[model samples]
Target: GKTHLASALGYKACQEGIETRFWRVSDLVLELEKAWKENQLERFKKKFNRVQLIILDEMGYVPFNKNGSELLFQLISDWYETKSIIITSNLEFSSWNKVFIDPRLTSALVDRLIHHAHILTFTGESYRLKNALSKIE
Candidate 1:
């Protein structure tokens, strides 16, 4: 549901000619890993750096490995105060450590992310669940 809202915002940004990119957290991490292996990490980072808005969907849905965590932190750090990032997560601030598995990194990531961020929480049943129920009726 949150991903839907974030993607809608990304779509609107695209329509307005904003340089927006959308990526699922896991998929991004995989891409970054590949870039690192191919010795094009800097190029990959530069590509993301040029975007005005990035919508990172489904953070904390799966825990990241140490390498993935570091790459993600670097991405966040590089974009800090320069671009807008819309992150959709099912976990709260305190539980973020579980995903990163490193307290310090998690803290730093959270600090950079929430520094000038506006958080919007969605409550109630998920859209998928609502749709399934409606279909069954």
Candidate 2:
């Protein structure tokens, strides 16, 4: 289901000796912005580079400013084919332009991400809500 599967995948990858980082899209953007403001941008990218897989959870849930969009595009460009990134987005491929803001950037990102990526789409009732309903019954 559409839970924190990205985070779980990251943890599993890390356990298999592949460095991984799990971060929500909003939190990741905020942290990256902070690093930029604090003169730690390079350090932040380095940290990101060390990870074999970076799982970004809840993409498209939060809107991004220009800086955030640029920062995210930079990350995607830097990791293109060199490292794997897993993005869990509520939006479909057609709607990715909304999150990315720029059409060119969105195309580049989709191309790179889909080049060697496996997409798993889940559509159903959320497990949490189903469980809660069962409990009430």
- lDDT of all predictions: 0.92, 0.83
Candidate 2 per-residue C-alpha lDDT over 18-98 given as tens digits, one digit per residue, 9 for 90 to 100: 987777889989998999999999988888656788778898998788788889888888887788888888799889888
In candidate 1, which residue pairs clash? none
The TM-score of predicted model 1 comes to 0.93
List the candidate 1 regions with Cα displacement exceeding 4 Å.
133-137
Query: Which candidate tops TM-score?
Result: 1
Candidate 1 residue lDDT tens string, 7-77: 99999999999999999999999999899889999989988766999999999998989999999999889
Instruction: Give me the overall lDDT of model 2.
Output: 0.83
Pairs that clash in candidate 2 = none
